[model samples]
Target: MIIGLHVQVTVNRPLGSTHPEHHTIQYPLNYGYVAGVIGGDGEPQDAYVLDVATPVRQQTGYVVAIIHRRDDNETKWVVAPKFRFVTEAEVRKATNFQEKYFQDDIWLL
Candidate 1:
């Protein structure tokens, strides 16, 4: 996904929420799926909402980057405020809770 594209996200996994299968892992940022969009995983396309101050159930933001996983087919979109920006290092830190298990790279718009 290109940056600056406004998109809505439904937060299936909010910040601090434990992973559905792996209870030991916690989501550091709002994590969810794009409505009505299917990804390589055969589910709704997943996205990570960043630059938000507090936890939320759902929101809309612009895409800043894509987290393409080498080990898995599913890729994740990084959403943030239009005026806000997230560095590559910050992106890694924010997603490392679960992403640590995958081989991935960040692609900015």
Candidate 2:
């Protein structure tokens, strides 16, 4: 029985190019997965598997949720579900080389 789930994600940022400075910014994001809603068995529901297109439609990246947090001087991994959204188009446009590079994390296809 699956009680919980964990997923890996990647983040990409835009950078200036040409005279300004031809450079690209990339970020590798990681976080624990938590169901947005509860399931019939009283467990958390898994996030519906979506391709890079999902983020493109929203024009946002997936937010990185730091499960570990500090509250009242007590630090522990919290279930805040905080995340950053990514664009599907940006991810889809990624090259196969990049995808294989970040295979452990989010895949670009």
| Global lDDT of each candidate | 0.86, 0.26
Tens-digit per-residue lDDT, 1-109, candidate 2: 1212233222122111111232342312211223354433354422222333322111222322211112222111111123334344433333222233232223211
> What TM-score would you give candidate 2 relative to the actual structure?
0.18
The positional error of residue 71 in candidate 1, measured at the CA in angstroms, is: 0.5
Which is the leading candidate under TM-score?
1
Instruction: State how far residue 49 of model 1 sits from its true place (Å).
Output: 0.8
Q: What's the true lDDT of residue 92 in model 2?
A: 30
- Write the residue-wise lDDT of candidate 1 on 26-60 in tens digits: 88889998888899899998999888767898989
TM-scores, one per candidate: 0.91, 0.18
